[model samples]
Target: MHEAKSQNISILSYLANRFDTPVMAHIAFVGINKSFLGHYVGAHEVMHDVMTKLNGTRRLGLPSRMIDRLILVFTVSCCWLAAWLDINVLSIVESFAGPAGAIILLLLPMYAVRRVPALAPYRGRISNVFVTVIGIFTVSAIFYGLLG
Candidate 1:
């Protein structure tokens, strides 16, 4: 039991570190409440809570949740601004890294989350949201590419 628990913690920590940049960059550039941002943020928070609980520490405060929601709102507003400026944020990422890269950008973190045993209970919800977000982004990107 102890060994399994430790392994889970290590995996979660690895995933959290790996996912940190992409999550931040996505929110910073592409905005949130769209794509997989909400799901990703939720997964991250859940992982954090799990880690804290495992360590026998307090769960994160409500303030953290509020901040996350606020960031989502801010990102959605920024998306509107980007549209006004004729900037296709997804396209920009695709331009630099290609379609596969964009898809991988979204999938990598999700794959990491799926690997954590601690998250097994929430796997169904996580995967459903993940697939939905990926589908939405894929269709939009393809349409945007074809039209643009």
Candidate 2:
């Protein structure tokens, strides 16, 4: 439980180490909601597609094919977000953490998900928490790589 919370704040603390509170907050917002990124000409439609695919995955209980889709999109999305933020945010994260961090961040969700003991029956709640953290770390890794 505690490690999860720590991971939750890890990005914030990491940002605090590098920037003032406001800019950190701005980056946090961008990394999370991603609506701000949608201000770009086509970002909105792309977001809709991602969201739809994600929702369907959840609704279908994350079949293997969907999981693969999620993994691929998650990786490519991290690269794209990292590249975009690098250009828009002065390249702080990219220079600081680079592709390695971005890739690790993108893989965090899979890490958390796979941590579950398969011998035991599935627990949706716990799985959700870990996966959520993974999502946060993955995108933060991108932004962090781009603007850290």
Q: Which predicted model would earn the best lDDT?
A: 1
Clashing pairs in 1: none
Give lDDT: candidate 1, residue 100. Answer: 59
Candidate 1 lDDT by residue in tens digits, 1-148: 3442444323333444557755555444454335457766676577556555544555444455665565557657776797678664444664656555655666555665678887677566756586758856875787687678
Task: Give per-residue CA lDDT, model 2, range 1-148, as digits (tens).
Answer: 3442444444654575456677777676667556334444265456556666776867855555655566568657875987665443323434555555644654554555557576234345566566667767766766665564
Q: Where's the lowest-lDDT run of ten residues in candidate 2? A: 1-10
Compared with the true structure, the alpha-carbon lDDT of candidate 2 equals: 0.56
Q: Model-by-model lDDT, in order? A: 0.58, 0.56
* Cα TM-score of candidate 1: 0.26
Give the best candidate by TM-score. Answer: 1
Q: What local lDDT score does residue 78 receive in model 1, on the 0 to 100 scale?
A: 71
